[model samples]
Target: MKLTISDLAKMTGLAKSTISGVLNNKDGFSEKTRQKVLQAAEQYGYVPNEIARGLSTKYTKTIGLVIKDIANPFYSKLTKGVQEVAGEYGYTVFLCSSFEDHHTEKEQIQAMLSRRVDGLIVAPLLEEVTFDHLFDLKAKSVPFVLLGSVPGLDSSYVEFDDYDGGRQVTEHLLERGHRSIGFAAGLPTSRASRERLRACRDVLSAHGLALRPEFTFEGAQELADGVEIGRKLIAMKERPSALICFDDVVALGVVKAFQSEGLRIPEEMSLTGFDDIDLMIFPLTTVSIPTYEAGKALARTLFGRIFGGPDTPPQRIVFDEKLVVRSSVRTAAN
Candidate 1:
């Protein structure tokens, strides 16, 4: 049995409109009357219907967060940051994962819209350029902030300086006298991977060296991919002295594959990774991005659009990536 506003009004000897106004926190109700209605509602255990209220006010007090993969530690940290800020604003978050599938991403966005979420924070899939679902959201005037870059989207986004991060890694390797270097790329369509690869090439070009075409490995999205790449490198007649992986997970996989064959890290071959994930077993030389802080920024940017008017100019927040040197990379002998 549920207590309605009418029941609350009868219990407190007040008009139904008075009870409704007080419960909804609308203006014009006297403090005494407000307290009276609240006391009766509390005593009677009256719970307001959120769906009904949302219809009247057009504010659901909820938001949706869609990420690439929830199992990834980077997104996990990012989610915590978004939740912390959303909590402070009295908003509930509906989380969804695309699992790096474009069709699934479209379905998730449609589901969020059907639920009437106030806003959305999405980490768009960089694989395959079509974003008709996201464009539809724009046409519908829904507020959304992207977590990563999507070329020609013309939307608000939060991203790390992947190009600069790649430059740093390549420069560091060059400084360590590592001229023969290889790059293990992520999904071929990934913008981050492309930017990093561009940086590596640019830096190497400036040093009168070039990334060998055969040295570049692509389509590394999982640990198994890294293991396969590792085996390929081992069988090569001449392999690069160092390898820069797309991310920490792939780097870890490569490390595992190498160790299984008695290959010592930074001794026989050096390796580095991006998005320095917290892994105790491997002290990888990688680029560290402030993933948690980036998540908070994504939510904050979305809320700004939600409350600060839709006319607010789109914001592009870019966080810097730091290169953390560890035992995985070493100076090459001249």
Candidate 2:
């Protein structure tokens, strides 16, 4: 016989609301209460019927994980972190990729909502800045966490210091006596790109350096795009002696691009990247953000909000960026 919430409550000798609170991890229940409820459920080998639970409580112990592009390594790391915690909590995750398409993002969100996911984790498509769908979610009281910065939304988020990262990379090149530095920025689909570019510009201006219009380029976070941008920059008449790529994927591409053109690393041109992707065994100089840590922190914060009640004063968690110095970057020779 399938056990119901009522049966579980009866067995635990707790009120229905108390059991519900325990299941949803709502506050006001002591840890002892929670443990008793859990122990009773386990002892009875009780399995929650998702459909019945949804109908009775209007909650689906599932979360929607929407990202702009999963092909990027950074997002992949975030996914790993989220999955690790979600597994421990015995919750399921529904993965959705927007591909930076707003229409598609909207459609996917609707689908997830229709399925009645309890919460959402999103890396919104910046171009499709419509929050009507999100507002509807809020109206339904579904918790949502934004990955990176989202304008016009006051909610939970997890992001690193992109501006400082850009400034540090640019400054590193400047200090190395490389006045001409190239920048390979990602698609303008995210605030991360904008902040990084702004920092680069600000640092350059502070050093009385001119940011050549030709030295900047934007592309998708694809290796091919990175390679193409690298080639274009290196082949210019007055190419930069140093390059600050958007991420390590782009830096790897720059390395390939320079190699194809027979340019030596740190000899003719120096290269640096961000996000210290795991497979980069060649020790590329770059900024490392513990993406896994970011993901875990984001999950913890989100779970806290869901159970501990809405946070006042807007919780903002910022992490420090580390500079990984490797052989890829070097001081320019006179």
Candidate 3:
């Protein structure tokens, strides 16, 4: 046979409504009733029918999270923050990884909608992607907030100040009296990447220095990709004395490639990276984005929209990046 709420109510010798109150953790249930109902439910292996509960309440009490890649430590830390906050709100989260692909991102959103999730928290893969999916979300009345930018969209988001991050690293290298700096740039589609590049270029241009075409290499935000760029940079006839990697993941590969080519970091050529991720390839000098805090903030922002109404005039919060001065840069050698 099958078990149901009635069975639980019968086993606990409580009315069905009383059992329900305990199950939902509603405010009125007595402590004794709560304990008795919980014990019976566990003894009988009682599992609430989510579909029926959702139908009755018109809310599933579930949130969906879409990330670029779970393999990245940044996302792993961010998910922890999201889960902690969501748990406090009595909401369960469904996590999906888009792997930075457009079709996959769309599919994940569609799947979440089919489940009638109460809300969504998406870290959009905006590089070279159209905003049609976002427009679709608005059309379908799905409440969502971006974890990062999706250029030209007025969606509420929490993002790192990549422009300042890039400027800070570039300035640090320049302060060390290094002018011929190399840039290990990331995905061309990432606005964050572009922002960093523009800021660094602008800073260099202002100081009467130019980012030579030969000195710029594609970093691609991956370790192996960074290594390839590292090899290319090392082979250059006249290489920059310092390099700015796309991000820390790519920087690791760059470090390995450079070391293999008989070069030492901050000794022969200084290097900097972005996102001071834990377990970095080295004690790298870079800009730091607080991923965990960003995750917590993302959850809070999503709930604000869910309760405050869809037309609550979405809010945007851009966090500042800190310049972490590690042992990667050369004073002409800090």
**Which stretch of 10 consecutive residues in model 1 shows the poorest summed lDDT?**
125-134
Question: Which candidate leads the pack in lDDT?
Answer: 1
Ranking by TM-score: 1, 3, 2
lDDT of 2 by residue, 226-307 (tens): 7898788766778888888888888888788878889888877888999999989866899998988887776766666666
Model 1 deviation from the true structure expressed as Cα RMSD, one decimal place: 1.8
Say which prediction, candidate 1 or candidate 2, comes out ahead on TM-score. 1
lDDT of 1: 0.89
Candidate 2: residue pairs that collide: none
> Is candidate 2 or 3 superior in TM-score?
3
lDDT for predicted candidate 3 compared with the true structure: 0.86
C-alpha lDDT values of all predictions? 0.89, 0.80, 0.86
Per-residue lDDT tens digits for candidate 1, residues 1-334, read 7778888888889999999988878999899999999888888789998887888888999999998778878889999999999999999999999887888988999999999999999988776658788777787889999887666778889999999999999999999989999999988656678889999999999999999989999989878888988888888989899999988878888998898988889998999999988763688889998999998999999999999877989899999999999888888995
lDDT of 2 at 37: 92
The regions of model 1 sitting more than 4 angstroms off are none
Candidate 3 on 1-334: residue-level lDDT in tens?
Answer: 7788998878878999998888878888878889999999898888888888998887898999998888887788999999999999999999999887878998999999999898899987755548798878877778898987676777778888999999999898899889898888877756677789999999999999989888887537678898998888888777789999868888888899988989898788888988889888588998898989999999999989888887878779999988999998887832
Pairs that collide in candidate 3 are 330-333, 331-334
Residue 49: error of model 1 in Å? Answer: 1.9
